[model samples]
Target: MLAASLAAGGFTADPAQLESPLGYFALYGDCTRLGNVLAALEQLWALRRHDINVKKHPAWYFTQRTADAALRLAERERLDPAEVRSIRVTMEPGGWIR
Candidate 1:
C-alpha cells in the first residue's frame, strides 16, 4: 500500500479467462517517461515473446499483447525516478481493488 500512487488499467476481462494462453496485458505504474516504458517493452521482446504489439492507445497496446493465455500481474510505481516493479497475484473473476 506504499505505492506512490495507484491507477487501474482500462483493459477489463473475466478473472477466470485472464490466465489464458493469449490474455490481454495492461501496463501499470508511473508512465510519465516513455523511454522507461519502451525499455520495459524491449525486455519482453528479448524474452523471445512475439506478441509484443505497440498500439495507438497504450492501454490497448499492452492489454492486447496477451492472446489467450497471458501473464497477469500488478505493477508498483516508486515515488522517485518513476521506476516500476511488477508483482504477481491471483485475481478472481469480478474481483478488484477499489
Candidate 2:
C-alpha cells in the first residue's frame, strides 16, 4: 500500500481513515486507499524533529566496541583458516538476544 501510495503522487488524506486500525495496517486491501497511506507518511515526515540526541547505553557501547576490536584483530593477525579453532561472543546480561 505504501509503495502504491508513493506512485500515486498526492499529499492529501483522510485523517479519520489514517488513524483507524484498518487504515494504518492497509487491511482494506484496496489500491484506491493508498492516498491515505501516503498522507500519513507525509505527516510523519513533516512532524519529525532534528534536535534528538541519542546516547548509547553502557551495554550497547561495550558490545559495539568489542565487535570493532575483533574486526581489527582479524585484519591485523591474518590468521590461517585451518589453525583457527573456535570463537565465542559474550555480551552484558540485558543485551539483545535472538
- Residue 39's lDDT within candidate 2 is 68
TM-scores for candidates 1 onward, in order: 0.19, 0.30
Q: Per-residue CA lDDT of candidate 2, range 1-98, in tens?
A: 56457658775666757445566445543324567546654664443442323444334554776767666778799967577798788777866653
Which lDDT tens digits does candidate 1 get at residues 6-53? 325344446634333343332334433556546766774543464444
Clash pairs for candidate 2: none
Q: Each model's C-alpha lDDT?
A: 0.41, 0.59
Q: How far is candidate 2 from the true structure (C-alpha RMSD, Å)?
A: 12.9
Model 1 ranges off by over 4 Å = 1-27, 45-98
Give the true-structure RMSD of model 1: 19.0
RMSD after CA superposition, every candidate: 19.0, 12.9
